[model samples]
Target chain A: MDEMTIIFSAFLNGMGIVFTVPVFSAMMIGIVAGMIVGLIPGLGGLVAHILLIPFALQLGDPLAAIAMLLGVYAVTSQTDSIPAVMLGVPGTAAALATSLDGYPMAKRGEAGRALSASYFASIFGTLVATVIFILFLPLLRALVTKFSSPEFFMMVVLGLVMAASLSGRSQARGLLMAGLGLILSTVGQAPGTGDPRFIGPFLYLWEGVPIIPVLLGLFGVPEIIDLAARNRSIATSAPVKKVSGLWLGMVDCVKDWWLILRCSVIGVVTGFIPGLGGTVAEWMCYANAVASDKDKDSFGKGNVRGIIAPETGTAAHLPGAVIPTVAFGVPGNPPMAVLLGVFVILGVRPGQEMLTYKLDETFMMVNVITVGNIIAAALCLVFQKYLVKLCYVRASLMVPFILAAMVIGAGFSRLSLGDIAFFAGAGIAGYVFKHLDWPRVPLVMGLILGGIAEPYFFASIDRYGISWLYARPIVLVLEVMIIFMLFSTPIKAFAARLWKSGVRSEGSKHGDNT
Target chain B: MAITPENNLQPVDRNQSIAFGRRVDWIVSMIILIIGIAFIIMLQSLPGRATIFPWFITISIVFITATYVYGKYRNKAVWDELYDPDTKDGDEMADTGPAFVLAHRRGVLISLGSFLLVVAMTMVLGPEYAVPLFVFGSLLARKENWILAVLSGIGLWVIIHFVFGDMMRINVPVGFLFGGFN
Candidate 1:
């Protein structure tokens, strides 16, 4: 079939999912489930996606499973924007940057506006990303093929360098955190050599550092401190009325089209990268927004664009991840990979034979993006108001529940007392970093990327010789991009600059009185 | 006690030598470089194909140490804020009330302290015990509502049991204390 035919058929498949078979109802269910799951502290998208996997499997077809999973996936991120905004806790790293602005916005009685803007922006960003991904699939397919080990190694190095440079007060502190992360990741038996660095006698540590608990510590614990330090009265402010307005939200979105579009693109592109996930995408884009804005002071002070960047960056990752799944058969995220495993078990592959010969696989791929995006949008439009009410649920009332969940999630993740210590340690480091105006994301990012990079680095160098990097053009391009990341301000910095200019018009009130 | 913001940084005990802490930083870097270089030397002594990381990391550490040395020539107050509590940026945001100042300071302490508490609690409680205990205690530390704390604890327990035990099948141990009564 021609490219136009594929697009037409995909567009039709999207329409089928959107209008027929109660897409609205599924989205409504998804919105509620997502909000509840996101508020559960450490669980976030991984848990929600894991729980939905069995159900998606029961549907027994690539498209149905994907549609259902996408419904869950899309709303998970949008809802995550909530607790982070109103309560200062985040569902995942994706919501980390959101809390910087969203929580402050909530304290200022614009919680409704913050939630509403993110909800719409999420839908908008996902749609825009979907369009871009669909158009760019062939190019993306061509791009991933050019990545050899040396290039991959170089890419990892660049990300590590950029992460250290962009993060913390100095490169020393950033590298130290990264070094610490590398040590923590080395706890389990080595992936290649089976040498466990620091597991001691515990079998739990034998598998290595647990992702979820580290997540709870890095993101969850600091929020707990913030909540505890604030007196109980911050939660009991008189509720802001006059929040309901569909038309007003639509108008607000129109004015911010450029922002929503740019951030969505950033999120999708980052998602397309193999190891860099939604968390990095959201943060990088949020920072990008701050960097590009002329009004630099408005970012953490409650700019709607700040909230939108992460929510959209993350939401778009659903479709963005789907690209890798359909194009290369590799899952781009933790939970999505689990679902993708089920797909392979049920007989799905993305090799040349699948794309060139298997019409059904191609159809399934198209439906995944177009159909899934609509399902997510319908859910957002219908249930955004109730999710906003969560912002008003008295931050005091929500704290006890969230705090309890965070500890449980951390404790249960590793099945060892040591894991808690790690979480606590990371949290302590996080607190000190925050107070000192240091960035904690680099530490987490280092751990995430470091664990994956070392093995790849050793193997690639041995197989291809040192010169293997120049042989792979895609790898060369990535290496160049990393160089840019090293020298330049992050995409987030640009976004922040643009955001500052917008807020200068509203006046940089320098942190709200509320 | 309050001088102009510019002079607020004048001589805590007089002398720029205090900022030489960066030299300690450089010395630490040098030591790391030496240790790494020694490892490479030992590897070359052994029957192996000489790896790249030791040299790579050692050189990088050396470079950072050199940067630290270069940074040390003057302006000690700028590089080493960790040792100097006398610095003004600690608790002084404009227009923030006394309550905010206190909360912000305590926020720093709580964040730092919670990290330690988790380590201690884990040592005594193990994961299953530690998870619930820490969850409850952390919640209890906030907002002073015991009822919500209990409910959240129950909720956390159920979810962890489901996610870790049933779904992911990652093992979590029960310590000999608390629920270890099993």
Candidate 2:
């Protein structure tokens, strides 16, 4: 009858799959599996995405496939924060920022409430972002199509500047780290020249360093070192109290609405943008929320807001990423791209009929997301208290298992020794980087986005010739951002300071930003 | 640059250790820089195909790291921790044990040992054999309680053997130790 009715109808139709027996079971299975994966460290989105393929193919129904896949993908960020808040270890890249406050909250006996905040923020963020995505799907698609290499290059420049600007300390070193990341990203395969760089016996090096391994080594290894260094001074705080009210926790979401809202928008926008993905959004939002907070002292030690930022950002991506995927058939994120493969295998076209809302197919797509979220969230609400207890396990008990799992997870992903070796090598390098006062996040981010940027930068060059860089306004804008970052007073100072401090300095503010 | 105690590296022996540790620190970082440079050089030597990004990155990184190493520390920050254990905190927090003893805890060594074991196993038996074996073995080795270790070991075995291997149709290589039995 009207646009509201059409939207409501779409929501209901999309949710109708919950009534089907197979879809219901699939939803539960997906959510539970996602939660488990999210609880374990080093098993990230990439691993989960890989794991979903075989199971997704088995499901066969495009609707069921979408439901299960999205359900698992959606809840991962939420469940991941459980471990982060309680254990001081993150299960995914996005949840990493959560550990800053989450673990601190646990140590302060607010683990339950903090965990509660994470789940609520995620659900609220996803729903709000999803609605916005559906409402603006048409306009967003048209806008993205206007983008060419110049726009993408500008976006990368923007992403680097934003990341640098947001890092908050030692601008010079932060800019240097970002530049180093971009430069390193250019390794292995020169995007413009197709020339290979420092590849060795490690053929995988040809693709540049594996970001996952680096992430594991830099963040995960350093954390392990901290735990080992602080062995006896383990948390003396009382365990978090579990109350009988899900509604109470849900209201906590209302108190921090602005924070969650900002993180959600941040997550959705970054997730929707090609290549920038959840990790950057999570870290940026987490840091921003902390910087903006009046109670900043409780941040890295533990706070509710810290836990919420990254969790909300990551989950918001469920809906945020779906816009580009469903409307344009251009997968905005890795998980969405893999999910598209399942859609293809199931003989369903992603964008054709879904946007118009004419076919039941669009309904099926929505059904999958809604069904999955409901099942996962419902279970989590029921078990939040018990799940929060997992945070108290001693690092000694967890370290061995974590190491085994990381090695196994990395090894299993590609079914190769090379991956494990690469992972270990990355971990050592990461450890060394920490000691040497080098920033590692930019290095990993650069590698992840480098491969993608290369082909596009090259294609654009070949298509319009080298003049294309100057021809486009967007490219010119990006050029300005890059130059601004390089020469900024704060940036130059940080780099010089970092070089001055070297490994024996107080980790100088220079390396801490990103 | 002010050398706040927090910036110091741990695990350096005290006494004559400062000079020796300084030498070790320089050597270790220098060796890493060299390896990185050599990696770049190897990539450069590869025949007429496109792939210069990796080498360029390695070279630049090595150069930067070498420069950082050359200028940063007058001496290794080893004794900085042992003598001044309350390094970072302006407040005095007494150690329950020696600093190095604490750093060399079972949790630390087991994890490091697991990494080396996996690398060695992978070299000897290949990845397929190494992944599951290492997974089960490391968990079994690191956990103090036998029951938990056994359960975790079996749990890991079932998942790797059944879920990943049988159902998912992924092939894990046979270990050299088990080649004769299977």
Clash counts for all predictions: 29, 28
Can you give the DockQ of every candidate in the order shown?
0.19, 0.20
- Roughly what TM-score does model 2 have, to 2 decimal places? 0.64
Candidate 1 error regions (>4 Å): A1-118, A168-176, A183-206, A232-237, A251-386, A392-400, A469-514, B1-62, B65-103, B107-119, B127-171, B176-182
TM-scores for all candidates: the values are 0.63, 0.64
TM-score of chain A of each: 0.61, 0.62
lDDT of 1 by residue, A1-514 (tens): 7765765566565555544454434444444555565444444665555445444444445555555555567667766766666566664667777878877777776766776677777777777876886678556545655555565556556656655664444665566555545445444555555554444566667776665556566655555555445523222333333344445545667787887788878877777654467877888878877887888899998777787767777767666766655554444554444445445435664434444445344544444444444554556556654554544444345554454455555555435565566667666644445544444555555555555566667788789877666876666776787667544643555688789887985575554532
Q: State the displacement of the C-alpha of residue A346, model 1, in Å, after optimal TM-score superposition.
A: 17
Q: Which docking band does candidate 1 fall into?
A: incorrect
Once fitted onto the true fold, the runs of candidate 2 whose alpha carbons sit more than 4 angstroms away are: A1-30, A37-73, A80-118, A135-139, A153-238, A249-374, A394-400, A434-437, A489-514, B1-107, B126-143, B151-155, B174-182
Alpha-carbon DockQ of candidate 1: 0.19
Q: Mind giving the per-residue lDDT tens digits that candidate 2 earns over A1-514? A: 7655666676666566566777667766777777765553334444454455445545646566666777677677666665566556565556667777766666666666677777777777777676666677556545656666656545545544544444423233334455455555554655455556665455566656544444455445544543433433222444345333345456778888888888878878877764456777788778778888998887787666777777777777767777655654445565665554455446555443556644345655545554556556667767765655544455556655555555555554344555656667777755545433344445544444445455555567567877867887767876887677546754676797788768545455556754
